[model samples]
Target: MKQITVGVDASSESRAAVRWAGAEATRRQQPLHLVHLWLTHGRTAQAIPHEEALLRAAQRLLQEAEADVRARFPGVRVTSELVTADSPDALVTTGGDPAHNDLLVLGSQGLGAVPGYLLGSVGLHTVAHAGCPVALVRGAEDPARLGDGPGPVAIGVSTRPGHEPVLEFAFSTAARYGTPLLAVHAASRHPALIGRDELEHHAAADHDAEQFHETLRPWRDRFPAVHVVEHLSHGSPARAVLDVAPGAGLLVVGRGHHAALGPRIGPVAHAAIHHALCPVVTVPHG
Candidate 1:
């Protein structure tokens, strides 16, 4: 069965991620897999005293994390593994495997200089390279808030094609949680509209709204149970999505793939992961 995979460590942020992933697994009725990595630099045999001690500590941390998840969410089937490899490589390989894992959850330590910025090297690397969807949970967030709150699941809608994965994930999540799906699309102001009349501005907004509705029509049909609220705004897409994120339970954005540059998290997904108040899920799509 596909499981929800989470990276665990001794940090408070990792604990928060465990809680979030545990809650998610319970809700989805799926098993949860906790992973802890001990960087051995490929020296697994005949380790020195300090290295051996560190290995023991890593094992203990994984055990403690597993115990905590089992205690907090008894119904959730929990399993754990200790891997001796590079942190980012191990996490990406384990959690990014589409055959076994459904989602990858990671702890996010917000950049301290900025209030909500949350991309560290490991998170950035994993999110960028992971084959499956990745969810970033902040240390300060309470899992209970996500479990019990009624905040809608917000998604940054793209009119462009090839975003079916993002749409499907957002709609399914909202359906599962029984919450509204706020579909937000921000259109840049057309240069032709410079010094335009009020009537022209209104017409432009109406055009954008129609396009947004057209993009969502198929999803609305597919997820009839989900209540979708269409939100059209002007200016930066990232800023528009962030504005609604403070009140959302979860934010879903698409990770774009560049033919030349390979898989990349776009500005909107980047902003959501770094600064969204709610847990941000970046769904990969080309």
Candidate 2:
């Protein structure tokens, strides 16, 4: 069966990620896989100092993360593994592999030591290429804010087409927590040129509002229990999302997958992940 996977290390940030992932797995009735990755270069006649000790320590960190999750969620199946790779690229590659995981979770930052990573880089690389959704556990200091709460699930609804996955994920999350759903559409204000017609600009804004409301109709029918609020603003999408993030329990955004290679996280997703005050989940949709 597919599972929810989280990168683990010896840091409070990593532990918080595991805690968040544990509650998510329990909610979805899915297994949790705790993964720790280390780099190894082919050794010559001699060995690097404390290399063995570091490897052992990474293994212990994985074990402790697994135990912590198991203790908190006894009914959820938990597994841990320690893998070797060449560089930080391994985290992105391993996370994108569909055979091992369905969802990849990461802490906002690393332990500032060996085997620990600054997830800003990891999140940027992995979410752009991962076949599944990537969730970055960032935000308020209180862990409770992420798990169960009254805050709504805020989503950035793209004015363009092919954003069903983002909408569905946000609505389902809100329904799961029995909270409200906030759908926000951020549109740029029309430029005031030498002969620009103000009437046409207002007409365009109205059209956008209508289309955004229409898009939510099907999702509203599907998740009747979720109370969804529609919001349309004239500003940058990233800035608009950041403004509403403080009142949100989680922020859901889409990562477009169209490139044949390399990271595909667009400017909006990059901004949301880096700036949002709440935990952000990047859903991949083509």
Candidate 3:
């Protein structure tokens, strides 16, 4: 049972995130924790209110959001909180209270220049820095299909590089969703397979793709119902993953250094956050 949390800021984007979280929580039969972090200093009209009243206002906002969530996902156990400070996302993050949470969900565009709310800096910082799996959701392409529930969860692995953390999360999510897990090892540089004939070369490439798939066998065994699938794709890994992101129920990517203490995962994870159509999960590695 995955315990999921979504950061809520009373913005449309955050609400969208809450709706997505509520539905996912229902599908997983998990609790939905709606967190709101309020800062004392602000330029908003509510800034001048009595501190007690401000807190009440925040609570009311979360309660309203909770009602909406409950209306849509009656099965989801909804919890609301109003933490006073700027640590909105962090307060709800597993980094602060690791024992209670399995995942963190946030909205995209809370920082976008557009008049509408989107993923803000807090959401980005939390995703990059959270202790547990973090998901960035920006609503759905089809609101009607939100009830369609989770589908195949995609995990990106490299033929030459291993992403154990990513594999673990993907397997766990697949098992939770009762859906399939697709392991993709996308090659950034494409080197034609060695063969004199076109058909033979294509066969070699396909064989290499199968090898990539075979590498994930050990993990697939851990999750018998995981329904493992594989792909050996060429072109930019990030772009390819994003291109196929739409149909996925959830996308899982590893956030680990190619070299420990190095910074490879940050940029790739950033790209995925900004582009993926479905909720993107980033699993950090040591």
Candidate 4:
């Protein structure tokens, strides 16, 4: 069975992300893979007597978390591991993790620090290279949808053909959520003529916007429920999506295909990954 992997750090945000991941696993009837990574560096001297005990404690903690996931979602299988590493990467990728996992959930920031990171650098790296879809959730948002209503899943698409996977993923997720998907295509900017009148400027901008919509027509048809909206913005691509994310429940963005390495979406995807208010699902361009 496909799994949903969540990187847990015992922090509020990590827990929040965990709760969200657990709900999703239940929703999809998939197993939950929870990982807790401990950082350690070898010392010249002998290790402390409590070091071994600490590992056991961590395992117990993970077991408790797994129990919570099972109680909330009884039919779903849950598994966990306690790993000690000197770095963050191994804990995240699961040291050559299995490919069966369909998604990886992570906190935007860690627990309890007053000045929490909105997107840690480690999280960013996984979003870029992880084989499966990655969801970056914020701890501030409620893990349980107690008061908030679920909204449409918003997915961003470039005119690029490689974004098909992302569009499909977003549409499927929207169907599962029973929510409409708003697929957005942001128009590329053309220079406003130096001395152009107001009407000319508006005309130029409108033309580009229409082109943007035209490019998205095929996508809208394939994902029938996606109420496609084309945004004609003069600024950065990431800026356009971030500005719209606050109104959405889920945001989906695409990474460029490795074959087209020159036009890779790492920077733009990275921007949306870090700045978007809603949980962001980064899909590697297939």
**How many pairs of residues collide in each model?**
0, 0, 9, 0
TM-score of each: 0.92, 0.87, 0.79, 0.82
Highest lDDT: give the candidate number.
Answer: 1
lDDT of each: 0.87, 0.78, 0.71, 0.72
Model 2 residue pairs with clashes: none
**RMSD of each candidate?**
2.5, 3.7, 4.2, 3.6
TM-score of candidate 4 relative to the true fold: 0.82
Question: Candidate 4, residues 1-286: lDDT per residue as tens digits?
Answer: 6688888776677777787888787767788889887768653345566778877777877887888787777776888877777766775467224477788888786334554346665666666667678888877777568124467788776766666678778877887777776756666554647587788777877877776677667756766765555455576777777776877889988877566553344756777765676788888766
In angstroms, the error of model 1 at 147 is: 4.4
Residue by residue across 255-286, what tens digits does model 3's lDDT show? 76546555334655766777776778888766
- Model 2: how far residue 91 lies from native, Å: 2.8
Evaluation by TM-score, superior candidate among 3 and 4: 4
**Candidate 1 lDDT, 1-286, residue by residue in tens:** 8999998888878888999998899889999999886665656466665786887889999989999888889999999998777556787899887789899999988558777668677789889999999999888887566446446899999998899999999999999889999999998578899998989988988988999999999999999999999889786999989988987989999998999999888899988888886788999998
What is the overall TM-score of model 2 with all chains considered together? Answer: 0.87
lDDT of 2 by residue, 210-260 (tens): 988888998999999999898897778887787778898789999886656
